[model samples]
Target: MSGHVSGYLSIPPLRRDLLIAYLAAAAVTVHVLEAALPGPGPWFKPGLANVFALVAFLRLGWRGAMAVTLMRILAGSLALGTLFTPGFFLSFFGGCGALAMLALLRMIPSSGLGVVGISLLAALAHMAAQIVAAWLLIIGHAGILAALPWFLAGSWISGVLNGLLTYLLLEHFDRHHALLTEP
Candidate 1:
């Protein structure tokens, strides 16, 4: 009985490890694209990898999502040679906030709020974490106010995009493999 229960609690073997690997690769790819594309602003990012993070959270729970997120961050930072830097910390915190929001969304039905709602919540979390990081490490007290506008705009836009993309991808996977439905 205990073994059966443990099995039930264990993550379903649905190629999640492969998916995590793919997501990590995707993150590296996106980071490279961002560097090569030369965006108008420093903060501009597609946040392409966030799609996987949300999916992991929804399907595999917080621990799984955090594992993937941390791995992605570590690999991504290493690839970009930004490890132990402020950028890595910002990304780490942002991912943590987004995952937390995704976990929260699990309590709600997927009908009304759905992915968009989750995205908004995650975006706000991401922004809040960044702001706190800035205050503590970058600029101190005044940094919060200074970071407000950019944080708001960035989080709103990025969150919505990430949410929409994640919804689409998850929907696709659900239809074919029922990835998120597995026990």
Candidate 2:
């Protein structure tokens, strides 16, 4: 429990809304810490915090997923002082793309994809949307095109790892739902 913030794990499950709020707070905390870590650059994060949205997608459906994603981005950006900035827009659009892609994949009968499949597609979508945002809002043109390879590489690697972690986590929760709330 080192570095765990006080009152973070102390949420009372009085209602579903409260639970979602707690989850959003946890995701935002993860986002902030992950952003603080050393990485390829400001634009590159392993995106471990994104698992919250993926989990919401799997357990609560796409609406919950989008809700969690949006809340996480808003709260995280506010915490990191990125609100209303280019970074905020990037986070916002990227999340929207991820949820939309996940929804599309879910609509097709027997895409036969599980967590990893959804995660990969969503990650690519998120990156694409972010890149497009950057091109339109900041980077402007071919200069940003050169960064595509790096972004894609990061997305694939992190997406796979995060997806696997989420799969295992969901499996664990399925077996131990009670344990999750025993703060």
Top candidate by lDDT: 2
Candidate 1 per-residue C-alpha lDDT over 27-103 given as tens digits, one digit per residue, 9 for 90 to 100: 66766566567665655556667667666665556666677778888888888898989988988887777777766
lDDT of 2 by residue, 88-107 (tens): 99889999889889889768
Runs in model 2 lying further than 4 Å from the true structure? 1-15, 40-44, 178-183
C-alpha RMSD in Å of predicted model 1 compared with the true structure: 6.5
Candidate 2: residue 163 Cα off by (Å): 0.5
The global Cα lDDT (0 to 1) of model 1 is 0.67
- After superposition on all C-alphas, the RMSD of every candidate to the true structure, in Å, is 6.5, 7.1
lDDT of each: 0.67, 0.76
Estimate candidate 2's alpha-carbon lDDT, on a 0 to 1 scale.
0.76
